[model samples]
Target chain A: MILAYIGLGNMGYIIAGHIADKLKQDGEPTLLVYNRSNAKVDALIADGKHVQSASIDHIARHADIIFTCMFNDEASKQIIGKDMIGSGQMKHGAIIVEQATIRPDTAEFLASIANEKGLHYLTCPVMGAPPRATAKLLVPLLAGNPAQRKIVRPYLENVIGKVVVEVGDSPGSALRLKLCGNYIIVTMVEMIAEALTLGEASGVGQNKVQELLAGLFAGTPVTDYAQRMTDETYDDVRFSLDGANKDTTYILDLAEKSNADIPMAKVFKNHLDKLTSDYPSLDISGVVGVVREASGLPFNLKKA
Target chain B: MILAYIGLGNMGYIIAGHIADKLKQDGEPTLLVYNRSNAKVDALIADGKHVQSASIDHIARHADIIFTCMFNDEASKQIIGKDMIGSGQMKHGAIIVEQATIRPDTAEFLASIANEKGLHYLTCPVMGAPPRATAKLLVPLLAGNPAQRKIVRPYLENVIGKVVVEVGDSPGSALRLKLCGNYIIVTMVEMIAEALTLGEASGVGQNKVQELLAGLFAGTPVTDYAQRMTDETYDDVRFSLDGANKDTTYILDLAEKSNADIPMAKVFKNHLDKLTSDYPSLDISGVVGVVREASGLPFNLKKA
Candidate 1:
């Protein structure tokens, strides 16, 4: 069996590495890799991993399955439509698993095209940060036809994740799950921002409020992620606020399509949009900065 | 020194009981108790407690300090201003400690009124519900003059709360702190509601998302309070959605007055408003019900 991997950004790279590592330990299944940036491919080759350099033709000729983990819906569409669709070396009976956060409609559209080409398709988005993926501590969600899901379950087990929750038998099911997970993250940031601002306004130090929060509400990700708000640790940020803004924006867009009113999420996105102005490179948790600013207090305090 | 404790709500009753119990043990100071509806007063009197047939005026004339733990600003003002002020029975050097969640402006206004009448006023709101207060687990924030705060510290120690967080000299500071604390609570609900909705949309069972969240981000109030959201447990509600909506609406009024932009909080309030419409009698945590509706799923499915 052969596996073709595409997209080598932060999440994609970690996942692809895990895939290569798994294949190596499990009798060395043939691996084919592709990225617009060839540097990643060179690095993998230098690491003594066998990576097949496949322009669309070679990937179709050699690989029994392809995994795509692109940035968004547009990127996923561009990669497949522009690069892979018309490659003359097409093979039948192959399956494609998409592990990217994209719109449900986009996933359905792509799955339809793949089905028309006589290929099985699965939407298998994941839940984790780059570090979590690297540590194999990610959560995976698989959604597709039963046969396509079973085909990818083996390689999925090879990756180090805490869960592989299989959902509905639909192309967009997994992506839908990922988007929902992101909605939670942004919502957490928004809540912390307002709470901290209220604390400051009340003349109770943020640290003191945080202490009480950590004690009573000790089991929520909302408070566990407090330092990200209190410390104003944004510049050297792990998750960019801009990225979160994009996700929220997309979620809102989807909500609009579904006619689901998510005023709370929209309000949070507006705050994120405002925050991006002053701290353009701010972390998503930098929303607390906006809160502090609106509270008319000093952004940061100096140690006495 | 005499102390008059008024209001016997779930939190109020426990805290007053703690104070009366402590004072009885100490045998130095006298404790008088009062409640609206006047029906519960007999029970306190029957317990050999200094339960009084007293109006706010009666309490004012007899006690060196009067502590009010009523429900809202209007109730507090009606009891303190109309009844207490109209009776004209307050002595010079007498102090009033308020322990209700009200607008900061109300606190400041009441303080101004008390000052004009040569009365020492302090806004000292207590944190914790009935169970916590019964165990003396509440956190108290004291906002007043140092002299007035000093006079009440010993008595406050008996029943107010465990930790006396000293805010500042502003009469409104304690109320501000209380509002801030509730801000955190409502914001948390908003985020949890949205996150759970998103997670369900992704085909990850709300229960699975809860499990993953508990493992990854289960160290704060946001997640701890989210147990209701995860488990879909909302029947025996502790804090009703009406209460949450009331608090959010109150805080938004303050935010608007202060000209602070609480777009995120505004969104949260909208969600709570929506929830309040459906589950009019549902607990605040019952906002999860609204989320379930948004996700097009059934909630509270008990395991067989």
Candidate 2:
């Protein structure tokens, strides 16, 4: 049996590396790694494990299971449309695990297309940043057929993530869950940014409020984001403002369709819009800068 | 020296009880407890430690250090304005610890009035609800003159809280920090509500999202709120809607004055407005009801 991981970006690279390193030790499935850039592909197989660089065509035809962490719907479509599903090249009963956070319609369309071609497609978008990915502590939301879920269970659980939340067998359940989860994260960033700004504006400084948060909200992602906001430590860029805004957009769209009122998310998205347009490369924590600037304060509160 | 605790409400009762219990053990100051309702005062002294039930006037005239947790500024003004400070019956060099979350102007004005009367008015607001208070684990934000802070330090730490976060030596600094901290909480409730509603709308169930939250934010108040949101456990009413809205009001007021742009806070306040209107007696977690209604789901998702 063979496994293929297509897309080696920040998260995908770390996740795929773990999969390759562990699967090589198990000595069962040879991992076929593919990336749009040749350098990333080279980096994946640099350790010379059970991993091998494979072309998209070879992955589509030969790989029994393919994991995709794509940039967006367009990128996923470009690769899976022409080379895999449309080309009629994928093996029968081959499973495709989508680890990308895509729109509900895109996810359902892909799932239905794969079903029509005698393939199983599962929406299994993950939650957590690159650090969580590196630690294999990410939470992967899995939604697909029971049989297909069973096939991919071993690879995802202890191999890559701390736990796998099985959303449902429905086509878009996992994708919707992904949007909901991302909604929580982006809104948390918004909340932390506002609190930090309020602290700074009140002459309490961000550090004291951060100390209070440590006492109250320690052992959470809130602390990590709060630390970044307090001292202008956003250059690490664990999650880009563009990606964060995209999820916010997806969350808003879901709210529109599902008839949910998430006004706070809209505001959070607006902040993300300003942040994304300005810094582009800064992490999501840069939302604090927008908040600080509004409070008649410096963008970065770090002391000279 | 005599120690007085002037409002035996939910939080004050627990906090004063702990302080009285520990003070009795140390054989230091005797605690004079007062409350609006006599039954609450009765319950407090029922343990028969170093606690003594006293009239507000007696607490005003003889107490060296006073801690007050009033219902509102109006109530605080009633007790401290006429009965304590305005009466001119209290001793010189007395300290008034304003544990209530009052308006910023109210805090500063109270501080000024107390200063004019030769009293130490410390804006020391405690963080956490009744449970944390009962556990002697509340975090008190102390902002006042250094010597006064030194006097009140022992009563707050270990006796009623885990530790004290000294916000500043400026008037209203503790109050502002309180607003910022509560902003994080209210916005967290908003974030959790929206996330839970989206989960229910997508048929993923609030429990799954709550499980995800436990993994990501277990040690924070977010988990407790997520549990309440998931099961519609707002009936317990840890913090009432009316009170939560009041703090949100103070936060928005501060944001407006500080020139900070907290659009998400505006959205949160709006949802809270709807919440305060509908379930006036429910906990702040009922914000989930508003989100669920918008998502076309029922208010209570708890299984029958």
Candidate 3:
């Protein structure tokens, strides 16, 4: 059986690299890899664990099990389109594991097309940043047929994820879960920004605000983001505003299509849009600066 | 120095009982206690530790340091009003530590009146619920004169709080910080509710959603509330919709007063308002039901 990994962005690179390393350590054949950019592919190849595939079609035809971690729907759609699945590139019964934050409808469409060609498709979008993926601490939200899930569970558990949650049999379910998770995370950033802004505006010292948040929020994402907000470390962007904007847009679109009223997501999207327009390169945490500025406080809490 | 504890509600009862027990253990003079309802006062008295004050005025006159943990602005205002602080009921140089969640403006007004009467007032609104207060695990956000802060620091540290954060010299700063903390918490509930609704609507089991949240949110308020949301335990009402609604309103008011654009808080306030109007008796976590309903999912995710 051959294994292939696609996409080489921050998160995708770390996760795919980890899978390849694990497969190599187990004395399996060299893993197959591909990316839109040759630089990431070259970087991975230089590390000496995998063979680079000539193209998406090459991996689709050659690999028994392929994992795709594209940045968004468009990237995934372009690479995993009819040409890859419908054109007889993928052998019948080969499994496709998708691990991107995409809309449920998109996942469903992809699943329908892949199923038509007798190719098994699983939506397994993951949670955590590149660092977590590198540490093999990322959690996968998995949704697929029971047999396909059983086939991929070993790699997801041993090679990449700390926890793999089987959401359901529907392909869209995993994507929806991922979008919902992102919605929570993005909303958390907004809440932290607003809270820190309120604290700074009220003449509470940044250290004290951090202390209170550390005490109250304890082990949550809010505490992690609170440190970033207090330190004004947006320049070291792990997740850019542009990426967050894409996720937020996807979430809002999903909510609209589902007729779910996620007003907090809407509010966050607007705040993010305004902030990203002025400082498009800022990290997702830079929303704190927008919050602080709106409250008439200085941009950086540390400086303030 | 004489010490008094007032307002024996769910949180106030346990916190005052703890303070009184600690003081008794130290062999200090009797701790003075008061509550609007005679039952809680009687319950504490029956626990065989402290003496009950005849009235708020009596505690004001007798205690050198008075700790009030009233429920809201109106309740606190009534007890610490002109008849109490303004009428020279509190002895000169006595200290009043306000631990209730109240508006910063109300705190400032109370401080002004107390100061005029040669009394020191400290806004020391705390984080954590009744159990935390009972365990002396509550974290206090304190703001007052430095000398007064020094005087109360020991009691706040040893008798009640696990950690004490001194925000600033302004009396209302602590209250503002507390409100900000609450805003983050309330907004967290909304985000959790929205995410869970999305998960359920997309056919993700509540257990899987809870697992993902537990892995993602970890030791945060989100995890605790996620458990509550999935169990449909909002009816247990440790923190009621009424209480959350009050805090959200205070946050929105503070934001408006500060000219801060807390759009997330505004969205939360609107959501809470709608939810409370329909299910006034629901726990704060009941906001999840509202979110689920909005998404056309069942009100109880567990049932769904």
Candidate 4:
């Protein structure tokens, strides 16, 4: 009945916290947590909930259900391959849940590997930043075996996120859908940036754009990014520009491999490449600053 | 207090109907309505509400607050200049409300002419399609004299639309903001098209994308358009590709004048050009079909 959580990045950290809290509330087995960095592990321990620090070997061998949210495909692959699967580390019939956004082919390959080892693997990549994870506003995409899906469904919805989008059987499907979601988000930022900048440039003011966005696109990411675009509050770095730029790489790669025509995504990637180089420390919404600069305006929209 | 409404296009017809209803409810003057063609006027008269068709000269001379929603600048100018502003056709200190999506300069010029002749001109461009107008979901952008805005604000909100974004004093300001709002919508279509096409091309399917869009953009136009994309419903055009393509002209014109570098809008324009050439009868959301065709797939997402 033991559950294990891995990766302690911003999104992973907040999500793992929710899972531990829910399990502890239900009086389930202690949640085994593992990360290369111990600070997050120590922070989870200090919270003194259901989470306990565990080494990779310990988590894989003991935990009945393991969740991984690593940085990239290669990192997630190594841990699932050399460290866990068929290495006498994980219990038989144990479930491995992947939340990291990796290439569809890579995810498919890993799912096959785990299946061959008498293990169940599922991809459940989520939509939204860490703040959304904290607020339980994230949308998790679930794809894999129906049985494994049923087992982990309790831990996702109303726990770490508000809803779940069942992406169906292929593990690649969830990851590909995750890329499509990211495609919507990043291109949405570009759309917001352009609209706000156009407003400012045309002397209509971003304030009016803000008003229109509130009325037209309320409860969506467009409103969320429009506020940031109008407010000039990018230094907080909730999701770093570097990470957003990295996502464009995967989105473009998926489009390239599939021969999908996503010119909007290409435009976003061009903006991301420029913005990530210029302001790596700002939040991903900093693409607005690039749009402002291209319009020959100052980086900040706030009037002095 | 005579009230006049000119033009009975799909949007204007529904809006004029609402205004006539509101005035009837309040026991005010019967609305003075005028249009070149009398079919819509016949239709309105047949409804047996508080509306009666009148000549342009009669409306100009008698109506205290006149609302005009014409097709283009030239037509609006001919009516405003030759039929309304002066030459003993209109009363002094009257107010003219223009709700057409005309050029910024044309609105400004109309405002200037109306002001010089002791008449008030206000631009009240609205967002949303004719269906939205029917549902009272339209967002109107108002810009003009503050006192004049005060005169018309009551008739706008809760009558034809839910809210009005008061865009500054310059009449052109509202038009500019309207273009910006259009920019957000059309670019949003491009983003949705690219994301759904990417999903289908990658073999993830638009159903998964539809589920994700529902969760991520629940209350926005993205959800509205995503449903159409996933369902392959394009022939029942709510916002025709021709009309959508015309809007891109104003949007690009504004961006060109303002020197705003909106690559997303440019991409949208390119797609609109292609989509309109191919599917003029389809809805503007039919841009998804172009994305699919470019990806070597069928125009529709529904399975055979």
Comparing candidate 1 with candidate 3, which one achieves the higher lDDT? 3
- Lowest summed-lDDT stretch of 10 residues in model 4 chain A? A237-246
The clash numbers for all candidates, in the given order, read 15, 0, 0, 1
- Docking quality (DockQ) of candidate 1: 0.30
lDDT of 4 by residue, A104-212 (tens): 8888888898988899889999998877888988889999999989999999989988778888898889999999988888888888888889999988888888888
Local accuracy of candidate 4 as per-residue lDDT tens digits, B181-285: 888888888888888889889998877787887787777778889888777788778888767877899999999899998998889888888888887788988
Residues B149-219, candidate 1: write the lDDT tens digits.
Answer: 98887766745565677777898877777777777777767666666655555445566556546655654
Name the candidate, 1 or 4, with the larger lDDT value.
Answer: 4
Worst window of 10 by summed lDDT in candidate 1 chain B: B295-304
By summed lDDT, the worst window of 10 consecutive residues in model 3 chain B runs over B198-207
Best by lDDT: 4
Evaluate residue A11 in candidate 3 and report its C-alpha lDDT on the 0 to 100 scale: 83
lDDT of 1 at A135: 80
What proportion of true contacts does candidate 2 retain?
A: 0.78
**TM-score for all models, in order of appearance:** 0.75, 0.95, 0.93, 0.97
RMSD of 1: 5.6
Instruction: Mark the regions of model 2 whose C-alpha exceeds 4 Å error after superposition.
Output: A302-304, B302-304
Runs in model 4 lying further than 4 Å from the true structure: none
